[model samples]
Target: PGMGEAQAVPYLMGHVPEGVTAGTHYLQAISTGAVFMGAVTYIGNAPNFMVKAIAEEGGVPMPSFFGYMLRFSIPFLVVNFIILSLIFF
Candidate 1:
């Protein structure tokens, strides 16, 4: 769940669930999760760190890790993922 999508896609591709097609819905769901996972943690993706640094340099007061998780990831990203699951998977 934490790994970046570029590296995690292989895991999804390799560990296909029983009865699930490798190239269809299952793969799509896994790919979506992997991509969305970047928003879950500050270190979860490279661009996040870069963006955080840029924001800080520009005088933005960023949240702590856990604060970010609770305020941003949990409230917004997770909800969006749930919606994605309901609509697509």
Candidate 2:
């Protein structure tokens, strides 16, 4: 989320720490929050469009919002969690 970069930059560079950096931290927090929410439901970004287009083309009714998440995003959530933990924690 570029948090490491944002925090490290000022700290390492020894600039005056403006409280404005809180905005950068806030953005990273929001992004992670969105990812968590989107993992449990389909309400973010391009996924809904792609899912709708493919479903329509295949003559399948679009899955319900949470249904889509249960089928697809849960698995991805697991994988993403594993990858992030390995890489960051």
Best by TM-score: 1
Give me the candidate number with maximum lDDT: 1
Candidate-wise lDDT, in order: 0.88, 0.69
Q: Residue-wise lDDT of candidate 2 within 1-89, one digit each (tens)?
A: 55686689778668755564646656765676567656556556677678778888999987777777777777877568667656654
Worst 10 residues of 1 by lDDT: 17-26
lDDT of 1 at 63: 87
Positional deviation of residue 79's Cα in model 1 after best superposition, in angstroms: 0.8
Q: Model 2: residues >4 Å from true position, as ranges? A: 1-15, 18-30, 45-58
**Cα lDDT for residue 53, candidate 1:** 94
TM-score of 1: 0.69
